[model samples]
Target: MSILFGLLAVIIVLAIAYAMSNDRKNVNFIGIGVMLLAQVLTTWFMFMTPIGEAVINFISDIFNKLIEFGTEGVNFVLGGVTVEENASVFFFNVLLIIIFFSTILSVLTYLKVLPFIIKYLGWGNF
Candidate 1:
């Protein structure tokens, strides 16, 4: 029942994209198919598997570690601050962590490591 609506929505979106594409002949249907399959499989793996719980925990641990690192950096700059009294704590915990993560990603991109990794993991080969 709900699946039918989901399929209809996907079809409509794809139809619109194809209709709007100027170079329709160059559209890679195989790549699109691969992407859809990958998306569905990844979602199923993340939701339906016990390994998903472990993956979630692992990611949580990484973020926790990154937060600790961010806190340490903030403390170095400000002497000390608590989340209760200072907005800087929140800024350091969230925004600085994001900036730090993005910097790491940017470095990886500059090194060409990200594209190499993404190509294999993503729809590039397909």
Candidate 2:
């Protein structure tokens, strides 16, 4: 049942792409196949390889540290509002962390680090 739905979704998306294409005859099937193969292999290695696992863990650790740092700042400014008894304040603090994350993202973008990473991930063209 899940597979049937997934196939249907793919068919619908392909149909949409075909309809939106301006020069369908100019499409390079070999290039599409190569890109698809690269995507599949990259996904497989990212999930299955030891080095990939280590890299994922490293990134997770960095993210957790950043979250902790943000929580500390929130606690200092909001003072007791983020306690377990104050659910609303805690939720607000979570939302506030987005500002900190976005600032960091903007700085990285300005430095071209993010664009380099995106290009490395095969999503640079956009």
Candidate 3:
């Protein structure tokens, strides 16, 4: 995931450079608009239903893994700290829950989730 995000960053930078070089003023606006929309939708979904739980769990899992790794290093230096009965797993579960939802949101958006959202949400009213 980190590698993918790094690649995305690189691609975005190159795209920005190309857009600027081409002098397409509207391109920047469009790019920003898309980003804003994606972020808003992501945030909205973050608060809803089982999807929210899934996303939280996913992120929590990532964090727990990192924390566990650090704890291992700490233990190696200080003769080990005992875990509190599956606490790590619980954290991971939460993280995975969140991440899963977020992943779904990303996939949906990539597949033009907005049209569905708009139609269902009656965004036309706005």
Candidate 4:
């Protein structure tokens, strides 16, 4: 069944991690367990809860707005080249959103918001 395959995949990944780890004696099982629990709970909530759906919808709306903003900038600079009847131009224009997201992420990193979460969550040690 699908569950068996999923379990196998997790085992394989953990085995690979164990093989690649430099300090094999210091494997933090508790941290791994906590992270796995968080992932499972988050997945369950995201798929099975109304509140999670609302949160996802809110984030999706924000992303759509950001993408629209990017498209506007692309249209301004490219002078409607992206709006032309060509798939290539449309694809190129879509990729412009990556630049927008990367800039936002870089700003968050500079402000130490991302690093703070990583440090406090023990993700840095992981």
Q: Point to the candidate with the largest lDDT.
A: 1
Q: Which whole-number lDDT from 0 to 100 does residue 29 have in model 2?
A: 65
Q: Which residue runs of candidate 3 sit more than 4 Å off their true CA positions?
A: 1-27, 78-126
**28 Cα displacement, candidate 4 (Å):** 0.2
Model 1 error, position 88 (Å): 9.7
Write candidate 2's Cα lDDT for 1-126 as tens digits. Answer: 996997688669877887899999986767766766776698788789999888889999999999888777776777846355545564656676887788789999999999998888765332
Q: Encode model 1's per-residue lDDT on 19-111: one tens digit a residue.
A: 999999999999899889988998789878999878988999998897787668767776775566545555656776677778878999999
The residue ranges of model 1 lying beyond 4 angstroms of the native Cα positions read 1-16, 85-93, 110-116, 119-124
- RMSD of every prediction: 3.7, 3.7, 13.5, 3.1
lDDT of each: 0.83, 0.78, 0.67, 0.83
Error of 3 at 26 (Å): 7.0
Candidate 4 Cα outliers beyond 4 Å, as residue runs: 83-91, 109-126
Q: How close is candidate 1 to the true structure, as a TM-score?
A: 0.65
Query: Could you tell me the lDDT of residue 16 within candidate 4?
Result: 99
Decide which is better by lDDT, 2 or 4. Answer: 4
| Candidate 1 backbone collisions, by pair | none
TM-score of each: 0.65, 0.65, 0.39, 0.77
